[model samples]
Every structure is written in C-alpha cells, then in structure tokens.
Target: MDIQHVCILGAGTLGTRIAFQSALSGFQVKVYDIHEKSFELSKKMIEKIAKSLVSSQIYTAEDIQLALNRLSYTLNDQEAVNQADIISESVTEDIEIKRKVWTRMGEIAPEKTIFTTNTSYLLPSSLASFTGRPEKFCAFHFHDVFYSRVVDIMPHPGTNMELIPILQDFGRRLNQVPVYVRKENHGYIFNAMLLSFLGAAGKLLVNQVATIEDIDLSWKVNFHVPMGPFAILDQIGLDTAWHVTHQLPDANSQAFAALLKTYIDTGKLGEKTGEGFYKYTSK
Candidate 1:
C-alpha cells in the first residue's frame, strides 16, 4: 500500500534522522516519544539539520521546509498511532520494548497500515508476533544518521510480499539504498560487523591500552576509518554501547558484562552524563 502518514516512535538519533528524511520524501511525519524533553530536543535538532541539508544542496530550500512542515512532534501515544499510515519504531534496541510497541500499534492502527521496526538485532518474526500481524510487519533498518544513505528492509517469511515493490519504491523515493532480507537474523548486516568493533573499542578504553585521542587518531591515520571507536562510543553514549554489548551472548560476553556493569553501577554513561570513558563538562 502507498504510505502517506509516516509516524516515527522515538526521538533518538536514528529516529530523528528517519523522520526528517521521510518527511523530505513527501510523507507527513509524526515523531513521538514518551520523554517530553527528549522529543523537544530532537525536534529542534531536526530543524537545524534540515537547513543544513538545504545549504549543502543535498535538498532544496523548498524541499527542506516542506519536510520540516510535514513533521509534528508529540508525546501522545494513541494519537500518534492514529495519525500514521506507516509506523517506523526506532525506540530502543530492546526486543521487549519493540514487542510492546508492535502490539500497541496493531491495537491502535488499522490493519493495512504498515509496521516497520528499526531494530538491528531483533528478528521480524518475534517482533511481528507481538502484533499478531507478522504479514504486514517488516523491518526497515537504517544506518546511524539514517538520512545519509544505506538502509536495509527485512521481511519475515510471513511478510506480505505484495507490498515489496512499493516498499522498495518508498526507499528509493527517500533516496536510500534499500536491501531486503527475506530471513530473520539478529544484527542484520550493518550492526553485525559494527557491534564487533564496538566491543573491541570499549575494551581498549577500559583497559587503558590507548588513550581516547590516540585511538581516534590511529584510525584516521592508519585505517582512515571515518571516526574512531572511542569517539563514536562517546557520541553514542556509553550506556547504549554497554547495553548492546551486555545483551549479546558471544565470546566478548565476559568482558562486556564487566565493562557494562562498571559503567552502570558507577553512572559513567558517556557524553550525556558528562563522563564515561572520557570526562565531559558540558552542561
């Protein structure tokens, strides 16, 4: 089905970028969050970012303004779902959180309204079961700063293939590279590789194997990686990195568990908390 009203549930980094880009693709967007302050901050951030896109000629002035106009921010739950023809849930990485969202969306929205989750780990099957509507449910996973380019569309075995072409068209309309995954898998494609690096980096910082700046510059000089792992960890918030690592059951589980528990217990939650692996004084 052709989606018009695109509702994004979450005011986080990925959610905000998705809403901004969706609106730019000509869909009326409603961005919702439970936290009032977070929602407001994200709204203003998007406004500034939209203007930047226009200045960069990545989007026209009219396109950017129209996109901004299409976006509405709210804390109301049922109202946001009611207004959406397509729901993109970017809330948290927790499966339980997404399950609740999916179940709630199904109860609030009409059957035809599409359901998509931005989760990188959780599979579409289990997530769709929350709504009893796995068929119309799918995963449209976006890379960080979602508006830049790459996105992956994951549909379970039960996903409605009738709309696959339309979904691809929608991704193209938003100027994204959309790849479809027919089977359910955790971490999809991008995050599978990303989480590996995330753990490795955190280990370094925690062990004092290298200072943050030394780690960052090493990447820039040697691998020419876009950003160093420590810098990224700070930007992503140590708590978030900790959570992802803690959730995974892998070879790194022991180290991740130790690192994460320390952060959580000590309240060193990265940039948002003014300290994590690094100290911050920003208020």
Candidate 2:
C-alpha cells in the first residue's frame, strides 16, 4: 500500500518524535492525545529536536518549517484516523488501556487503514486480536527515531506476510533501518540486551553495591561511552521503565520497581519532567 497520511495515537516523547519524522519524510501527519496539555508538550519537544537537526545541518530551516506545516494535532478519534493510511500507536504502556484504544480504532478507522503499535515490551500477538483485524496488525516498534534509528517489524502469527515488505519500505522512507523479528519476543533485539544491562545497574543500586553515579561511571568507563544505564533510564522515562520492570516477577525487578516508584510518586518522571536519576535543565 502507498502510505501518504500517518496517524500517531499519542503525544508523549516517542509519539512526538515519530510524528515529526513522518512529517519530515513528506507524510501528512496527525497526532492524537486525550490531554490537551500533551499537544503543547509535544510541540515543544518537536521544536527542540528541530533545533538540533538544524544545528547538525541534517535539515534546513525551510525544511523544518515545511515539515511542521504537514504535522497537526487533534483530540477527536475519528478525525485523527479519517484519512490515515496507517496508524502508529504509542499510547501508555498499560495493557488494558492499549486494548481499549485498539478496539476503538478498529471501530472507527477506515477499512483500508493499517494498524501498527509502538509498544516497548508488549507482544503484537497479545494485542492483535483486539484490533478485530489480526492480519492487518503488527508491531512496528521504533527506538528514538533520529539518533537510534532502528524500527522493528514484528508480526503476530495471524499477520499477513505481505506487510513485511510494505512496512520495511515505510521504515526506510522515515529514515530508519528496518529490522525483522522472526518470532514473538518481549523486547525485540536491542531492547532485549538493553533490559539486561539496565537491570544490572538497578540490581547494584537496590543492593547498595554502588551509588547510581558509581554504577553509571563503571559502565561508561568500561565501555568508553557517554551515558550509563541510569542516565539512559532518565532518557527512557522512569515511569516507562517502572511499568516494564514492575511487570517482571523477579526479586531484583521488584526492588528496582520500588526505587522507581519513589521518583514517580514525586512527579519526577525523567528528563521530560526535568528529573529522574539525575536532574536536567529544561531546554
């Protein structure tokens, strides 16, 4: 299918980035969120990313302006998907919430519209049936659309094999490296390794083996990389990390989830909230 209109079903950090990049790729994009405030936040985040792209000379000022012109925000469900050739959902990481959203989308979206979820840890099979069109649904997970540009195309058992090439083409159009997940897996490829690395850092902190700074320093120094696990967690958002961690039925995961809960309770979700494992200055 030739995709021209893209619908993003969230206005959070990742959703905003996906929508921005889709627009930059010359698609007419609409971003939908329940909360009106999320639109303002998404816009600010897009502006910040646009500035970086400009500074890096990845895109010109006029290019950014034209991309912004193609992007839009809305609250109405029907309006969001009315003309969408494909929908990329990045809603909250909760199962129930996602099921409800998919069910509604199945009802309102055009019959020709393709469904894709940007869920971090959830399997496409778990949510595919809820869409009322399992063959048309798949997981097209993206990690940091610009910097980390790999997009995972994972299909459930019932998904049509034809979608692979279509989605692969779409991912490339959005300037991403498309990776095919042969089977249903929790964290796909990179995230599976990432979860283990981050879990180790959390274990050290919960066990009092080292300070967050020290643990992060250990990884950075050893790997000769800039950001460590804790710093990376902050970028991923503490709430999101907790959501995935708390679901694991392991003692170490439970301990790490509890640590994350304290930060969340105080409304310090991460860099988006200006704090997490470390404080960040607002751009």
Candidate 3:
C-alpha cells in the first residue's frame, strides 16, 4: 500500500515525538488522545520541540512551520483513523490498556490500515490478536529521538513478511535506522539488553555496592556515554521505570521497583517533573 496519512494514537512523551518526526518527513499526521486536554498538551509539546529544533539548527523556521501545518489534533476516534494508511499506537505500556486500544482501532480503522505498537516491553503477539488483524500488526519500537535514532521492527508469528520492507522504508523516511527483528522477543533486541543493564545498575544501588553518583560517573568515564543507567531512568521517567521493574520476578527487581515507586509517589517523575534519581533544574 502507498502510505500517506499517518494516525498516531496517544500524545504522551513518545507519541508527540513520533508525530513531529512523521510530519517532518512530509506525512500528513493526525494525533489522537483519549482526553482532549491531553491532546492539547501534546500540541504545546510539539510546538516547544519545534522551536528547540530551530534554535539547535536542526530545522529552520519554514521547516517547523511546514511540519506543524501537516499535523492535526483530534479527539474523535473514527475521524482520526479514517482513511489513515498507518496507525501508530504509543499509549502507556499497560497490556490491558493496549488491548483495549487495539480492539477499538480494529473496529474503527480501515481494513488496509497498517497497525503498529510502540510498546517497549510487551509482546505484540497477544495485542495483535486483540486487534483482529494479526497479520497486519507489528511492533515498531523507538527510542528517544533526540539521542537515539534506531527503531526496532519486530513482527509476530502471524505478521505478513511482505510488510517488513515497507515498514523499514517508512522508518528510513522518518530519519530512523530500522532494525528488523526476526524472532518474537519481548522488549525486542536493544531494549532487552538495556533492561538487563538497568537491572544490574539497580542491583548495585540496592545492594549498597556503590553510590548512584559514583556508579554513574564510573560508567560515563569508562564508556564516554552521555548518561548512566540512573540518568536514563530519569529520562525514561520514574513511573515508567517503576512499571518496568514491577514486572520483573526477582528480589533485586522488587527493590528497584520500590525505590522508583517511592519517587513516583512523592511526585518526582524524572526530567518531565524536574526530579527523579537526580534533579534537573534546567534543560
């Protein structure tokens, strides 16, 4: 199918970024969130990011204006999915919520619309079944676009193999490096590795092996990377990190979950909220 109009469901952190990238790539973008207020917030976020891109010289004023012009925000489900060639779902990582959204999408979306999920850890196989279009479903996992530009495309057992190249080309159009995953792996390839690293880092903190500050410094000095595991947790949001930790079946995982949950409960939700493992007073 010749994809043109892209509908992005959910306007949270990742959703807005995906919408921006799609619009920048010259796709007609439609954004939908369950709550009208949430969708409004996403619009503000998109505007903010567009200005930042201009200031950073990554995009020009005309470029930002053109991209914004291609984007539309809507609350009507049928209106959002109607005539859309690609529907990218970027809701929270809750399985039940994902299933519910997919069920609705199946009911409202056109038959030829390609369905993709932006879930980090959940398997797309079960979710695809809920969509009533398993063969047309796949996981198009993306990292934070500011730093990471790689997207993992993992298909379920029922997914059509012919759709892989088309999705890959779509990824390239959005200026992302698409990595195709052959097997059905929860978290795909990159995230699986990242989660393991995060688990170990959480263990070190919980076990009192090293301080968070020192551990972060050690990794930075050695690997020459911009951020450490704790910093990454901050970027991922404490609530999100807690959700990931809560799913693990280990004592260390439980401890990590508790630690993150404490911060979340206290209203410190990472960079988005100003504080998490560390405080971010400024950008």
Q: Pick the candidate with the highest TM-score.
A: 2
- Best-performing candidate as measured by lDDT: 2
Tens-digit per-residue lDDT, 203-239, candidate 3:
9999999999988988888999989989988888787
Using lDDT, rank the candidates from best to worst: 2, 3, 1
- Full-model lDDT for every candidate: 0.77, 0.96, 0.89
Candidate 1 lDDT over residue span 27-115, tens digit each? 99888899989877686667768667777888888877777788888888887878677888888777778778778888888766888
TM of each candidate vs. truth: 0.88, 0.99, 0.95
**Number of colliding residue pairs in each model:** 0, 0, 0
Off by over 4 Å in 3: none
Give candidate 1's whole-model lDDT.
Answer: 0.77
- Candidates 2 and 3 compared: the better one by TM-score is 2
